[model samples]
Target chain A: MPGVVVVGQVARDLVLVVDRVPEEGGSTDVRERQELLGGKGANQAVACRRLGAEVELLGVVGADRAGEDVLAQAAADGIGVGGVLRREGVPTALLVDVVGPPGVRRLLEDVAPAALLTAEDVRSRAGLLQDAGAVLVQLQQPGPAVVEALAAARGALVVADGAPADARTRRRVLDAADVVRADGSEAEALVGWAPRGVPETVRAARELLEQGPRVVALAAGDADVVAWADGHVVLPHLGEDPVDPTGAGDAFVGALAVALLRGEDPRTAAWWAAAVAAQVVGTAGGRPHLDPDRLRETVRRHRGA
Target chain B: MPGVVVVGQVARDLVLVVDRVPEEGGSTDVRERQELLGGKGANQAVACRRLGAEVELLGVVGADRAGEDVLAQAAADGIGVGGVLRREGVPTALLVDVVGPPGVRRLLEDVAPAALLTAEDVRSRAGLLQDAGAVLVQLQQPGPAVVEALAAARGALVVADGAPADARTRRRVLDAADVVRADGSEAEALVGWAPRGVPETVRAARELLEQGPRVVALAAGDADVVAWADGHVVLPHLGEDPVDPTGAGDAFVGALAVALLRGEDPRTAAWWAAAVAAQVVGTAGGRPHLDPDRLRETVRRHRGA
Candidate 1:
């Protein structure tokens, strides 16, 4: 049985890279196209699974051809899909990432209502969520589902990802979460506004740490700040310009969860998260392709520096 | 056998309608998603086929899954796929039409080099092209392929669609063509500039007529001018807003060819083309779902007016 559970979206990700975006009534050719299994939940689960964290995903995918395809991919990636629900009468979610001109990206998401986990689905997966050593909940889902997942994972190292859908879910999540991870906009949803600079982001991360989570990670402009009870660490952005940043955050949180599950302290785990995230943005698409040994070397090098 | 042969691209078309396009680093959910067989060649072929014309398509698609899927769709639509070349090693072409706001569309085309018809591929289909009653060539393809298609259709009602790639191909097409249809931008390439009003479009059409075509159609701001040896007719655009204008021109030219093949006079055929174009823009995506009887009625009403 997998020791970790990921409760979030499982979608078909299509990446179309073009040299430049054309104006309205104009056209541009796509230089690269990648169709893969992706979504924050699937990406994070794949990241954790790649690092040898036995992981099972809890999410809803519509009963369509793409659903079958993504499930086959998840199984091949060594993640358990038993907890995934195939809701009838809808097509699976689709995320199209149009990357143009260096790091510019536009996203088109098709997450239908039926493709999202309902409270009923989360309740039905209580056994899977409760038995996991750690459970990560994507708060972007419906409020009821987010709260249900938080409640189901009683003693697990519960991690909350993204901003809660509403204030009620926010309260419930903070009451139960052991770790929190949010990107810029989501951090703005948690704190009053988006923090700028390393010092301001450190203050913001510390503010989140006071709201129930033992460790809090928040993204600043080009760097990340991770704060805990005693101290904090500010990680610089990857040196090279990123090919695509669509899935970097998911990789970071997944690495952070895996490191914590392996008994690493908060400081070392944040370093691991940063190193893994840097590797992910160096490639394209939301799904992470991880090499554990290489990632370890990168983390060690960064830490020594 | 169908009497119409369309020579150009064969691609998988994806229409994603979003409420609004997101800014950089932002995301928007797709309001609707439509995936189908599309391309200038395939769209025109489908339109001709729907009007009871026996149509065969000559184009190149990659030897990929999308190729197989689009070919299956063409076959199901009663268009002959015998002349469609399946080149290995390259993925099938994809055209993504992102429709936002009313009538605003951004096209992302993935027409890889291998997905385009080579001169060899076009030449190989000489028998099919020669046997057709009308052959429509999309000039957006490589120059050699367009020239080969024009040369092969020596005795057919040669129709050139879109802008020719180079001066040589343009001269060859003008010399060989019996009919020419171009939208505003393509009209600019044929002439020196895009015609602004109906009268200017009429002059542009007459100028094209002197270049060899017996019938020439040129799009102006909101109307189309169809010129012949004696006089010209300016057809106003469809009254309602277009849902997506991605394939309206393809439908117009296809309907025109079908009407002329059925022995309708140039004036009545132009009316049919206008009526069909109006109906096509009422829907999203490039593939047209045409009703012959309904369109004939609409054309009769418009022609009588």
Candidate 2:
């Protein structure tokens, strides 16, 4: 199978669960904080891997301890780390998180560790992108450079999660991507909505059709989704209390990329991806494995794919 | 002599230097990165210790690995950590930094790990504050709560380093502080300024008197400072090519608190603090130390007090 190449926003997520948000300058009593192997690239790459897509992670991590942890986690997830160039002088990027009440998450992240990926490293890994079936990119790392690399690749279907994108960034990405995935808020941002609700989000997704992605997946929290490509489809929410929605979008994209690689129809692929994402929600962390049978069943029952 | 108290934001700081800031949508390469033990509280307390102040840090740290490092650094600095309460639940607070060319500093900080400080910890450390000759507070920690604690203290000469303050916070602190220190930019932030040079900063210092601080110390980078109290005095900056200015402010405040405890006149003490701060600028990292002779010579040359 042609592999899905994930690039951009690599990080080691340090997660902590505390009683409350530290008051403005007020401190909290931290009960538990654990380092989780994560980054936008790694999370989506892991998502593709667990959903049974051959995936390769192309990025640079430091030669420091966090890099070792990044390699270990990538290896465990079966994503290629060999392409990950290691810089001896720099430390890995870190995302510090505070998981607050009702599952609200505050991410304080710095993506500079991935910034150490020199032009030479990018040049060296250029060939890997050529062989992949699909390429996924996030905004965490530098976005334009990744776009330049994607522009050079002819074969792969480009999946862009224009997350963390502002007006200018989204415009830059809309031109480069084949499938664009927008979270509820991002969709609002793209269409210039004010204090958006479900209808506004739906209206925004419809307007995104002009930007030219073949498919646009807009994930609205519990309202599930309303998507339009050839026509409109309202997909049901997984209907489970999301243990942690940290990587749900990554999983959705990963699974979607995998289905697309398999040459499934867009609707079918999205259904399969949704089922895979829902199953992942049952697990506590991001990018949990999707049992082959369960993935198929959810696809058949809900996602027409 | 009564000891000194540093009441401010305390957390571990990770410092990294890169070639240039990442372009709006692009990435840049990092040349060096390091984890330096720091926090405004930790920096000031450690500075006081280096300058020979009997100092105690009154704050909360998480029970995680970072907290352990914070504890160890405090021990090494000879600052009492008994008041450094370790709550079992939270991870220690952290400051992430990206410093660019010409020594520009951007504090990409997350105080999540520092959320562990509780009201109880503040209450427990109250008596220690009351007995101190001087107390230093920075805006890195919660403002309102810290202000309340200072308001309750009667004996300590409260020196509020309002380097990073807002109108509301400045007002609250002025009500409780004996002296409030602000850099030229910070002073301008309170009362807008278009100062051209030394005269402008001096003029700026005069404007800060309208605020509640009995004295205002305005620090201009590597230049003479203008202080307003009994009378105006100009203490020249110790000339040095600074590699990193991370803890210079803390060093200044720490040495100032110590000098006050030693019963040095204010101008003489400011000179002592300037020397210590100059030493910090010469060093590559935070909280660099200076012994008795180094302190005395720097003071004697100034001929201020």
**Which model scores highest in lDDT?**
1
Alpha-carbon deviation at B291 in model 2, angstroms: 6.7
What are the clash counts of all predictions, listed in order?
1, 14
Residues A1-305 of candidate 2 have per-residue lDDT tens digits of 87888876567876655565542213344445556778778888887887777888877777876788878888887888877877776667776555545345555555663444444566688888888789886654454555555564557888877563465556766776777777765555555663255666566677776777777777665554435476655566663665556777778888787887788777777777777778766654454656889777766766543
Question: What local lDDT score does residue B132 receive in model 2, on the 0 to 100 scale?
Answer: 78
Clash pairs (backbone) in predicted model 1 = B2-B54
Stretches of candidate 1 off by over 4 Å are A188-204, A286-288, A291-305, B188-200, B286-288, B291-304
DockQ of candidate 1?
0.79
Candidate 1 lDDT, tens digit per residue, A1-305?
Answer: 24999999999999999887778777887888998889999999998988789999999888877899999999999999999999888898999999877677889999888888899999998999889999999988899999999999978999999988888888888889999988887887776578877788898888877878999999888888888999998888753678888888998999899889888899999998988888888787856567778777887787885
